[model samples]
Target chain A: MMHINDIDTPSVLIDLDRVEANLKRAQDYADMHDLPLRPHVKTHKLPEMAQKQVALGAIGITCQKIGEATAMADGGLTDIFLPYNIIGTSKLDRLVDLHARVTLSVTADSTDTVAGYAARFGAAKPLNVLVECDTGAGRCGVQSPEETVELAQQINDAPGLTFGGLMTYPPRGNIAQADAWLHKAKAALESAGLPPKVISSGGTPDMYRAAEGTATTEYRPGTYIYSDRMQVAFGVGTLDDCALTVKATVVSRPNVNRAVIDSGSKALAADAVPAPYTGYGHLVEYPNAVIIALSEEHAVVDLSACVDKPLIGDTVRVIPNHACVVTNLFDMVYLVRGDTVEREAKITSRGNMR
Target chain B: MMHINDIDTPSVLIDLDRVEANLKRAQDYADMHDLPLRPHVKTHKLPEMAQKQVALGAIGITCQKIGEATAMADGGLTDIFLPYNIIGTSKLDRLVDLHARVTLSVTADSTDTVAGYAARFGAAKPLNVLVECDTGAGRCGVQSPEETVELAQQINDAPGLTFGGLMTYPPRGNIAQADAWLHKAKAALESAGLPPKVISSGGTPDMYRAAEGTATTEYRPGTYIYSDRMQVAFGVGTLDDCALTVKATVVSRPNVNRAVIDSGSKALAADAVPAPYTGYGHLVEYPNAVIIALSEEHAVVDLSACVDKPLIGDTVRVIPNHACVVTNLFDMVYLVRGDTVEREAKITSRGNMR
Candidate 1:
């Protein structure tokens, strides 16, 4: 029965109703497109949110870190997809342990990573391994369709390993290029007598546009559940669709045209918004105010164009540029319906970078 | 008893020998300047580091949040200063409780914050209050010496508040302007028949320049103990002076000129190195390699200029641009003397924004 004013300043607030709507939207989009949705748990980092996504018809969960996948599996998430290369002996041991607990799948970009996985899981259950393909993201992945097929062949031939699928983290809002690259990779795999079981493509920007005819059989959108300013700029959702925001108190009004909030890079995060949008985060009430700079614990706001400026001691909700990074900054977030708090949800997989 | 290679990737490593030297440097500088040093704990957020700093001749510790001060107080540090204007009822109550446990002092830029403190601690021990003067940093604090005197008068007239002194977080390396402003504020307060007990000014960049002629009687330098890339750029310390480094594994070699590390914005933080310096951090091994960009889980490195590039599975230590922000990104930091693990210290005051 805590009021909005009762909670301490500079805390994260999640609108439960908005979360449900966002989840439903993702589920409905997947259903309409006939795509199996595997929401990346790296965004929310909360098992409760993952469970909600699962209950809303997500086929499984995707995680970038072993620590995240382990936490999700421990929280009773049966199917988990780790779409990142798990290298080194220490990580392989954790991977094997997680494989025994859940229907686990992992991705690898190089033969060395695949070899490490095959050697470690040789005595255990057959681990599902996917070949990560580089589309347009320019991150970790094989260079060409031929390279992806070569890696897939290595996985298929390796002991105690199943050639699960092909996955790519495409550039935001550029699924067409990914579709073409994935199609070429799928064709190459088929021509090599090894078809990928699953063709996965992921990005929150182009999530709803993942067509049925595309090579992508599954979609993984991490930031969709908590649409941020970046998502809003991508034309995916509006400010009202944003579920999470930082409740910050204006600690200092240095001048009439400038004010500082309690939330800084520590709370709002240092993830810059995409072009055409500026500042750290969007102030819901003071729309014209731009958060120009942030130190460790202070967000300096430029209130020159604001029709009404926030006074010192007033609380304002700031929608950060990237909600995923913001969630990692806090230990617990408030689940709220309107102004009343429902409960506090712990960021279960927070700081699980390893 | 963990080996360096056995530890997980993307972990924070602290050098005890460097930390000891850093502590000695700050203490010796303060001792030579005839000023009491109060190191800010917001950088390390570890009780063990704070204790070590205290044992090395720190009069007290300073923290930004009450949560940090309370943690330090709990860890047995006696005196603490919170140099942020704390507003609202919920925080004021916590401030009073914190005052009851330790000798606590707070800074305020407005009369409203001072009034809140006066109301909360009217019956308790008189709370020491410092008038925060904005000396060219342009963040929080009063505008002029007159405004500083007015706030001092407010604190002195308040029933349970004692006008402790004046403090300012000056612009980096601009101690001259800060000294002039603080001197003006001090003169005004003295003219008003309220001689200040302490005059504090802090910035690690100009910490050594805070001599006896300056109005400042106390110095609080947060980043002096863990010099980072930015500190090196400021000519305050060299790369060898850095005590903290993030150990990261090269997970992907996209090409001969590029490699990706396990440490990203999550490990190294997104705080860019100040001007004239490029990249996210300084690579100790590959001096020519530039950390071009960082996603959530991958730090893209451009090794075009390096004589030798790092292969997949190779480990490198990165000295972050800002060590203070990097400290907040980790849950546990390993304390090391040479190659041996001294202990794993928990970041006790991390995420203590409230």
Candidate 2:
């Protein structure tokens, strides 16, 4: 085994023990609720880590893109759910090919998307389509219960496609709204002589507050595996549960109150804003130190609180503002156990942004 | 030939014709100045693009990391300059290996970094070291010309290293300060009976404004190849010269004023700060619209001014805030000529961050 110091600076380090602990915690929550846990693999994007989640009794995995699902399928994790609308012929072709190799299900919010998937897969390789309901998170999916039923009915009638379930990712404070939306959509589906067998509803914030009795049979939470500063800010997970961190070296100490690290927007990632984040990222060793600013190659961290300030060569670990985007910034992750690097895993699906 | 529409969404599209034109413009500037042009390959890490620069009469290519330089050397580019401080044992080992493979030169400001490199090289393969004088960039490098000379003397006397030259990335509007510092440093070196050879200077912002008779024989500018929103904000290039743009699909129209694109931080990158600029990125089609915010998977563009509103399935292109960092976000880039897809080239050194 290589020593932790032997790897490289500005590298992504994952504590295997902490990751396992995090996985078990989420698994325990799912077990307690009697909900099928489909851990979203977007957080790690490494096959080895995904396999570990499967070993911890995950039903399968969830992916955001067909490219990621294909990578996971190629890595031998056969069951995958892509909770994003699969649009365009290029992506649909890849989806068709992936469905041939794996048990694949995708989300749809419109008749056009459902019909496109059905036309591509038309009874040849039937795709499982989940009706994505927009409970609160106003990103994608159907707006109302009526639209959900209309899309579900279209999926049921379309050739080579099976309407398997209802899926949604609600806003953090609105679990009740998600439950209400799912209930109405479920009732509408049943009244139309259709039943959703797999009702998947989850986001990291609302996963713990998930209501199982209200048409949700499975939960898909990606960030729960390796919660970040964003999750911590949202009250999703404590700082101790953050499994991955960017180990950076202090490259410049130009002033008494501030220092610059080798990790900048390129290393820590630029997904540092969109509400509660005060700066670029959070310093793991120095929690009080705020990353006041960032350049493409330098991160300006204010280390005014530390009694013994970080010097020009000191190494510090940083938990990025958002973990999922940070995961896509690296090619490999060092799995560390104490002072030893136990393994190096390729971020095989790191840049699969199709 | 793959049609332009056949490519997947959220993928990097490079206008090859525009890229060639940009390259020719930079080459013409270098010729007019009678200075060697070292195009920084950190913008586009593709070997083919680096070769194209070399074919267009660039002296060499500059890389920020040793891993990127090594990849370039492996791909058959012999001359390379690493304009970053090389610290740590793992990086030192790679630098030694790279020096053996190519005509390698690196920048350092501190004696500790220079000594580390010198000790590793050990006279067997003497490494060329350039003293980096801080000309108000406030990032790295020596602050004073006297300090630069002291560091240079240490490198000159070191058994395994040769003091090659002086380099500084001066802040914009402080070109005179850079000139004064380099002049004083050059005088100091000459007084010590050690005349430096390669006086490297120039950043993209100060490329056109580089002062004459500053002993700068070679100028390195990376972003001149594919200018971005920052360049436009800095009044460096027009939108027509931006060779790269993210071809994104309008995935959701949540409200009348805003529309969300599939390209978010993961695709456009989060290095969208630092400038006379506002917003996350610049929309190519709707130039007036502000990219109000960004999530990991979504970019919210405020399109209130456009007479024609974007639909859920409309495709738009975004010129990212920082083009260089954006290039590092993908594994491959599609080279396009007008509406035609020309070729697909691997970003060979995309994640080489050792």
For candidate 2, give the lDDT of residue A147: 83
| Pairs of residues clashing in candidate 2 | A123-A160, A270-B270, B123-B160
lDDT of 1 at B244: 96
Docking class of 2: acceptable
User: How do the residues B38-113 of candidate 2 rate in per-residue lDDT, one tens digit apiece?
Assistant: 8888888887889999999998888888878878988889999888788777778778778888998998877778
Which residue runs does candidate 2 get wrong by more than 4 Å? A123-125, A212-215, A252-259, A273-277, A311-313, B187-196, B212-216, B252-259, B273-278, B288-290, B310-314
lDDT of 1 by residue, A1-354 (tens): 987777788999999899999999889988887898999988889888999999999999998899989889878899999988888888888888899899989988998888888888873589999988878787888889999988898998988899998989887667778888888888988999999999988888888787733898988989999899999988888999999999999999978898999999989988888889999999999999999999889999999999899988899999999998888889999999999998898887788887
Best by TM-score: 1
CA shift of A228, model 2, Å? 1.5
DockQ of each: 0.76, 0.46
Best by lDDT: 1
Across A142-165, the per-residue lDDT of candidate 2 in tens digits comes to: 888888788888888888899988
Task: Tell me the TM-score of candidate 2's A chain.
Answer: 0.96
Per-model i-RMS in Å?
1.0, 2.1
